[model samples]
Target chain A: MYGTNPFRELEALRREVDRLFEGVASPSKLRSAFLPGRSARSYPLINIQESGDDLTVEALAPGVDPASLEVAIEGGSLVIAGEKPRPAQNVSPEAWHRSERAAGRFLRKIKLSVPVDEENVTADYRNGVLTVKLQKADAAKPRRIAVNVA
Target chain B: MAENTVQKTNGSTAVVATETEATREPERFVTPPVDIYETAEGLTVVADLPGADPSAVDVNVEDSVLTLKAVVPEADESEAAYVEFRLASYFRQFTLGEKIDQERINAEYKNGVLTLLLPFAEKAKPRRITVKAA
Candidate 1:
């Protein structure tokens, strides 16, 4: 009864609908374009952002064993591989109530558009998210240009 | 005797989030995935809440309803040249029945996963009676 105003209600409803598709309309990641259904998409989805001097890669990989995680750069592609063990391995199957969380091994290789300095890479995992920072190779970095008038 | 059975409150809604509502407007939520299992002593629930600090995660149970919510620090993505998933708060809820022992519930958080233990009450556990013959 409180939200009875027709105009206000319509405004709220429109906002909700717009939100549902808000982030979805952004450009799809380059690697997912040819991917099939939702399930076919790679596990532990990642985001790559570029600043002036570094490229940051963030991977959503929860409950992954640190000892099992492997990150490496091969040529111009970045390889991220790891295992996500089942949260409860000792629990008997008969006692299960629900198992909606996905658990398994996953590996993703992303081709970098720009060369990266292989020696200055660092990666860390915290709060179930993995952040990897790589420095751009000197030659690939944006260079300041000067125009001289005689 | 309450048997402590668990059920999802809604398709994905069991939120008791005054704290979350108090935050800035237009905040989005992603439904975290979960796993539930039972044992002779009680039931255990595990949920995935990535990018949210352990201190920011909140778990509450009241009136036979269990709610889970986690807040992640906001990151500046406006300058991001490329984007994938956005960091958002995690939200989900479950309805607990008499089959669980509410008084003895315990919780644990690690690696962005929350595990809740809902023990069975004394009355709910099966008991065996002894028979004597003359």
Candidate 2:
């Protein structure tokens, strides 16, 4: 009698149908719910902004060690790599009611539209967010034009 | 009749204003992901709230309801070249049971993650009784 029960099979089928509908309703929510211990898309979500002479990129990453994070400018692209550690306290898997946070090594590469002064790039980590500020090349900065009165 | 109607409308408006002022609704918020685990000691909750300042984070328990809130600084969206995740404050809540020790709960925030240690109440903790030989 160590086998699947008929009632359990029916319950599984019902859940599958519910999940299908949920996916259609809110794809983002469903995607995250489906992947319990792993990221549905990318490891860290990012936002990139361009100011007068600097390109700033902020990466949202929680539970990641600052020392483990690595940022580098390769060719015309910026690369970010880091590892997120799992909870240190050991607990049996069965004791976990929910485990939604994903942990592992991740690498992301973003291509820059304009050239940057790689030598002057600076990075800082605070409150689980990594901010990278890249100084734009001298020629890449927007120049103001002056017109003489006619 | 017109005076009575005006008074009733004013009363309703006052009530609405008080309610809104008490709640102080936030413009935007995101539900942070969490992990709940049970241990021999008690229950542990780990929440991920990126870009939240540790000093601005708040955790409160009232009438068996646990509330978590964190304020995130606003970023300049006009100069954003690329965006993926939504930028918003973090807000979430959970209902606690009588078995939890509300007074002894502890919380820590580091690397954008908040960890809460909810120990079990004295009465709810497991105990063993000795049996004397008959």
**Each prediction's TM-score against the native?**
0.77, 0.76
lDDT of 2 at A6: 84
lDDT of candidate 2 at residue B76, scale 0 to 100: 68
For all candidates, state DockQ relative to the true structure.
0.35, 0.30
Q: What's the lDDT for residue B110 in model 2?
A: 95
Q: Report how far off residue A27 is in candidate 2 (Å).
A: 11
Per-candidate alpha-carbon RMSD to the true structure: 9.2, 17.3
Worst 10 contiguous positions by lDDT, candidate 1 chain A: A29-38
Worst 10 residues of 1 chain B by lDDT: B10-19
- Cα lDDT over the full model 1: 0.75
Error of 1 at A22 (Å): 4.3
Candidate 2 residue pairs that clash: none
- Report lDDT (Cα) of residue A89, candidate 1: 73
Candidate 1: list runs displaced more than 4 Å. Answer: A1-38, A147-150, B1-26, B130-134
Q: Which residue segments of model 2 deviate by more than 4 Å?
A: A1-40, B1-26, B130-134
